[model samples]
Target: MPDRSLNADTVPAAGPHDVPKAQQAVEERLIDTVLQSFADCEDPRLGQVMQALVRHLHAFVREVRLTEEEWDKAIEFLTEVGHITDDRRQEFILLSDVLGASMQTINVNNEACGDATEATVFGPFFVDDAPRIEQGGDISGGAVGQPCWVEGTVRDTEGSPVPNARIEVWEADEDGFYDLQYTDDRVSGRAHLFSDDEGGFRFWGLTPTPYPIPHDGPVGRMLAATGRSPMRASHLHFMVTAPQLRTLVTHIFVRGDELLESDTVFGVKDSLIKDFVQQPADAPTPDGRELGDRTWARARFDIVLAPA
Candidate 1:
């Protein structure tokens, strides 16, 4: 049986000798009062979670000696974030992404799966029911960016093909804007497709380019105030799913992007970086498709999925 006690480990340590004993006792009692308030929480997991949250939050407040005025400002800032969030934009997710919480959650939940691909942040722009495209079809939908050919094989950890696997992809254009960033509803640079029996898939997309996270929002203002840049590295977002296999939400980054080392969302992993080679107009494509008077880029991303 698990230990149900909230022992010494659950509470913060005593203050230094220079600090007033009365103040420390007051803080400790305040934490105890808060914890007791939720002691009767019906769900054990919810009780544990709430207890931990209160303990950590109170410790943080004491550590920073947080002022009432600052707390009010934080409440106001979060209120503004909620006000700006909608179907097209998710400011809270943007806030979490910038704070590294999103990446940290991904790390904790996704463990090593043999040769299976690594996972990263899902960002704030994934759309459902994306238009399905056929093999070698263009997904850019006339969005502005240099032409790029993306080909990949989806496989299981055992190296067998994952036939009929669903792969959804989305990215920003050369101007660093996702389709939702426009005033009107326009679907660009987004699509979903299935892998063939051989686990092969292909599509035309824009070369991944570095783009700033929507910086006009509250999250962006927070980044600017903290002297941080809102730039995410050049990359393509991918969500892959197959029967009996874990759904993977990740990104493939351009190997030489300047922002790779300093992505605001901290979503980059060494394994997810790949070389996006530029191909001349005369280069032969994998499907023997001909490019006339047009230079393009090519990248192959083989994905391996872990059993669910």
Candidate 2:
């Protein structure tokens, strides 16, 4: 209170105790000044986040002796990332993916995977509320490469079946491209389904294939600059929710997908991979198409949920 405005700019003269005192004084003042900037924020969460962000940003600038040129380049990169975002795509999520921030967040929040199935990253390609189908149904309604049959049980951590559970599933075709990626006329490989009284559901779809994520944007360029691949491993996406249960969103990777070791988004987990093999032509399918003649991959994976 003693003329802080006047004293703030005046550094103590160099002396035996002067350096330490000056350093402490500067630290205290910097913290106060930074926090004061956020004191006007109405939301407590926003204020806390802004203050922490500023503290870390300033600390980084000081610690690295950050160059103005480097800062400008960073600003440019961030602006590009923001500018490329829209309803179907989010560059920030892509940024988080490349930096491994998204996986770290998932790890921190989903640390309780003792016996329940392990959780994995949620990719950005999902469209909420797919059309609902029934057990033993097929989600893939478009051009399928290899017919795949996926049947699974929905159960809680205690091994109890979750009745009437809603299971949302989607995946890329054998070509590593989603339905949305193709022309507007295709719809063979997109559908949704629900569980039964015994918490069982089944679906048929095409075998997923290793494919590249969208690489025409800045994230793609960044990956190229870093010499990293832009391919996501073959996998099936599922989101399950029911009353009194923890909602789960995850992927069931196809074993031996080429990109399993190097998924562009780092979403692959060894535990998430399952056997998706080909069946003979004698197998009964809703389409009644000969199986091996066209090469099909069959997979059955059960999801173990956490109690609410």
Candidate 3:
């Protein structure tokens, strides 16, 4: 009745209505807009996700009355973040870490812990296809720091050994730097090993030190803007997968690592800390090598797998 004669062709698909109905009408319009935005998406799952994203994003924009200037600045930041990504680096992941999105993702996907080891975030620094080495071998390559013997067992939650499990492990060196971050020294300490026939794995490395992640990019700018340091605590990363078992990605943190309470990415949890024990030089290493005149710290922890 209201303007049907003058602007009959200009009516919105949704009508301006009673105050309560107004919101419902707008929501319906938004849903339709989201659906149309992803109409050409190829992946069905991705399409669904993108549609949801659009709906939420639109809602946020409307609720906040986001201004043109602020939105343009947001776009500029995201564009620069993308520009900093490369084959071995991901600035988007860095952004996610600082914003706590990466930790949220880890919690969402790793929902089970039936005697199985708890899972944690896979940080932006993973390297695919690291060098493989034998169990009980020295991975440290004498990088000057506290020596530690890292030994562990792979087992099912039922207490049975999980033989043939693939254990991918890597850690920062003595000065708290990853081999890749400093040099192309592929020959350095970071390496991979597998559980033996008895579901046991072993290696040696210098104690990890707290170090800052590269803050030379857009992510760094964000951290600086927020007064946050780019440092991560000393810890070792492990990913293990076995037959009919769930894959696990987690970190074994140094008990005394100062950044445990303030891990730059908020990735630290008390349950993940492990002690590195100092032992006399005469003690036998897991390798049966005489701990010849070398003081060492020994840490033993096991990973329990969940059945598929």
Clashing pairs in 3: 277-297
Give per-residue lDDT, candidate 1, residue 73.
Answer: 95
Q: Write the per-residue lDDT of candidate 1 for residues 49-93, one digit (tens) a residue.
A: 999999999988887777899999999999999999999999999
Candidate 2 structure quality by residue, lDDT tens digits, 266-308: 7877779998876666666645655545555677888888776
Q: Kindly provide the TM-score of model 1 when superposed on the true structure, using C-alpha atoms.
A: 0.92
Residue 246 of model 2 has an lDDT of: 77
Model 2 pairs whose backbones collide: 133-192, 140-188, 140-189, 141-187, 141-188, 141-189, 142-188, 142-189
Candidate 3 ranges beyond 4 A from true positions: 1-32, 39-44, 141-144, 280-294
Candidate 3's residue-wise lDDT over 59-117, tens digit each?
Answer: 67755656799999899999999888976678898889878889888888887767788
| Lowest lDDT 10-residue stretch of candidate 2 | 12-21
**Which of the numbered candidates is closest to the native, going by highest lDDT?**
1
